[model samples]
Target: MRAPTPVSASLDDLEPGDQALVAEVSPPHELSAWTAWLTSLGFEPGEPVRLLSRARPGGDPLCVRVGGSTYALRRAEAACIRVWREVARR
Candidate 1:
């Protein structure tokens, strides 16, 4: 089977109902903030996340539903939000 395609971007780029796992963080320095915020929402480094909605139009906050909870994150805080295509799961 083929591996999933990776899309690297900030969390704000994700669309509603989109699902993906946290891949790598760019620069690595922002790991602490990312870890803390994600951990609070039950999103571990390798856990899957489902995009629920964007906080506001053209805003940096992205509202994502992960592990039955919703999380709002700033785009800059999550600098390297990588996601895989759901089709690759099949």
Candidate 2:
């Protein structure tokens, strides 16, 4: 059988413990200021990334691991990063 196609989605869509690869960083028009900063944080295309967890009460800030660093990003900020979901290996 042919392998399944990979799905692309915003980083915020990843569940805790899920992993994905950085696909693109396209912040909305108003949030465009963060594009360069996010890329500097290793959110560039093809980097490995993982969703660590979400804040309680409201899942506003999401903890994510990119490259060798960990960062807490607001949901809106996380949404600026597009990612390709990584399938778990057996």
Candidate 3:
């Protein structure tokens, strides 16, 4: 079987309306406060998520949807979460 091509990227790299799957979330330090916050909001590997919107003035806050819930995350917070782009098959 072919290995999946790496499309992993931080949330800051995402554009609005992009659908993605949670890939790997590496906190600045393992088992830290950052990890707890992310996991609580369903930022886990294999989770279906999408970038909803970006705040005005700057993309400091990003709205995302995971499962049936939505969240607003800061650029710094979202940067710690890595995700894989979900490309549609033709």
Candidate 4:
């Protein structure tokens, strides 16, 4: 099987309307906080996340909807977030 390509941009770099699947947590610690938060919202690792909107001026926080719940994440933490392009939903 072929290995998946790595997503290089921070979560803050994702534009509104974009969707991606969590490929892996880069650096691991980057996702520590996010993982806990997402779990409470039913968003598990490898789930799809839709970029719902941008938050704040400098793009420090991003609004993403995952598993029917919306979440706000910081840019620094998002930098370590890795993802793959989300395929079409069946």
User: What C-alpha RMSD separates each model from the true structure?
Assistant: 4.1, 2.7, 3.8, 5.8
Candidate 2 Cα misplacement greater than 4 A, ranges: 1-4, 87-90
Q: Residue 76 CA error for candidate 3 (Å)?
A: 0.6
Clashing pairs in 1: none
lDDT of 1 by residue, 34-76 (tens): 6555555565567777777766677657777766777677776
Best-to-worst ranking by lDDT: 2, 3, 4, 1
Ranking by TM-score: 2, 3, 4, 1
Error of 1 at 58 (Å): 1.1
Give residue 88's lDDT in candidate 1 (0 to 100).
59
Positional deviation of residue 31's Cα in model 1 after best superposition, in angstroms: 6.3
Q: Over the stretch 1-90, how does candidate 4's per-residue lDDT look in tens digits? A: 455554545455678898887654554664476666545654456778777877668765877777767777666656556666633333
CA-lDDT, candidates in order: 0.62, 0.92, 0.84, 0.64
- Cα RMSD of predicted structure 2: 2.7
Across 2-59, the per-residue lDDT of candidate 3 in tens digits comes to 5545577887788999888888777786546888789888998899888999999898
What is the TM-score of each predicted model, taking all chains together? 0.61, 0.90, 0.83, 0.62
Best by lDDT: 2
Pick by lDDT: 2 or 4, better one: 2
Where does candidate 4 have its weakest 10-residue lDDT segment?
81-90
